[model samples]
Target: MGIADLLSDVWGTFSHPAPDAEAPPTGGSSTSSPAAESGAEKEENKKDAKSDDGGEQGHRPSEGGDEEEEEEEETVDPKDTLEDECKESKECQPAKHHYDECVDRVTGQIDNDGKASEDCIEEFFHLAHCATQCAAPKLFAQLK
Candidate 1:
C-alpha cells in the first residue's frame, strides 16, 4: 500500500470515532472538563472584579499583567521562525547550498538505484556548523 493508505489505516486503528450527528446529547455535565469548569469560574471571578470598581479583569492596574498576557497570546510558528532565522544568516549560504546539492544528488541516486551509495553527513555537518556559528550570537542577543 501507498504511504497515504498506510497512514489512514494506522489512524483508523488508533483514533476515536466521531459521534453521529443524530445521536442524543448526553447530560450537560458529561461534556465540561475540570479545566473548562475552572476557566468558567475564573471568567466569573474576573467579571466580579470588574464590577467591584472600574478596573481591569483578573489583574490590578499596577500589576502590569497585560504585557505578559499579550506576550503569551503572540505565538510564532516554528517552521516560519526557522526559515526566517536561516534566511537572515548570509554567512551560512555557501554551506547550505553545498548541503542542498548533496541532498539532491543523493535523492537522485536513490531514485535510480533504490539506495544512495553515500550519505550527506559531511555536507550536513558543515551546514549545521555554519548555521550554529551564525545564529548563536543573534539568538543569545534576543534572549537578553
Candidate 2:
C-alpha cells in the first residue's frame, strides 16, 4: 500500500473508538434538571443515574486496559525496525544510501548556513519518501 494509505490506516486505528464502546452523548439536556416529579419517575431517575455513574467508573478501567495494549503493540521503535529491514534487504540499500546522503547533506548545510533552505527541506522529504518506499514491505510485515 502507499504511504498515505498506511498512515491513514494507522491514524484510523488510533482515532476510532473500540467496537464495544458506547459513544458519549453529543448534545443533551442535563440529567440534574427539575423534570422528574412523580414517585415512580424519581425512582426510575435514581436507577438511571446509578447506571450512568457506574458506566463511567467502569469505562475508566477499560481505558487503562487500552493503554496497556498500546504499550505492548508499540514495543519496537519504528526507526530501528526500518533500519533493521534496510540492512537485511539488498533492494533497499540504494534508497537507504540516498536517504543517508540526503540527511548528511542537509546537516552540513544547516551547520554552515544556520538554517534549512526550502530546497533542502524539499530534498529531505524526497529522500524520506524514497526510504519509506524501500522499507515498506518489511515495515508492513512488522506492523502485521
Candidate 3:
C-alpha cells in the first residue's frame, strides 16, 4: 500500500479506543446480594456502553482529516526545504543561488499563466538537479 493509505490506517487505529476495555466501576454497596450485584453490573455496563459510543462518535473528525493530511503532504515542496538547507551551508551558496532563481522564475511564470507549462517544469527540474550536484559533497553523498 501507499504511504497515504498506511498513514490513514494508523490514524484510524490510534484515534479509536479498544472495544473490550471499559473504564473501571465506581462506588458500589459492599453487601449486595447475587441478583443485586448482577443488576448493578448490568446498569454499569449500560452506562459504560453509552460512554463508549460517545467516545467513538466524538473522536471522529467532522472533516476528512486523513484526506486533509494527505493533501498537505502532497502540497509540501521538497525543493523549498532543500533550498533552506542549502542557505544554511556556506559551501552550498552557489547551489542555493541557482535554486532560488529557478524557484522565482518558475513561480512567476506559473502565477501569470495559472499553471506550469511543460517547458517550465522541465527547466525547474533541470535547475534542481544542478543545485543537487552543486551541494556540499559530504551532504550530497549522504543523500545518495
In order, candidate lDDTs are 0.72, 0.66, 0.62
TM-score of each: 0.43, 0.32, 0.27
Screening candidate 1 with a backbone cut-off below 3 angstroms (N, C-alpha, C), the clashing residue pairs are none
- lDDT digits (tens) for residues 1-144 of candidate 2: 999999999999899888998978796755566672567656676766677864542212434455554444546678666856655567656655666677787778889999765344555465566556767777778779
Best by lDDT: 1
lDDT of 1 at 136: 66
After TM-score superposition, what is the CA distance of residue 90 in candidate 1 from its true location, in Å? 2.4
- The parts of candidate 1 lying over 4 Å away from their true place are 1-84
lDDT by residue (17-120, candidate 3, tens digit) is: 88977889998855345555566566665666677964642233437456565434466555566655655567555655666677787778889998765344
Error of 2 at 18 (Å): 44
Score candidate 1 by TM-score against the native. 0.43
Off by over 4 Å in 2: 1-88, 116-144
Question: What is the Cα-based lDDT of residue 102 in candidate 2?
Answer: 72
Worst 10 residues of 1 by lDDT: 28-37
Backbone Cα, N, C clashes tallied per candidate:
0, 0, 0
Q: Model 1, 47-125: lDDT tens per residue? A: 6666887554453353755655444577775544654577457877888888889999999999999999999999988
- The alpha-carbon root-mean-square deviation between model 1 and the true structure, to one decimal in Å, is 15.3
Rank candidates, TM-score, best first.
Answer: 1, 2, 3
Summed over model 1, clashes come to 0
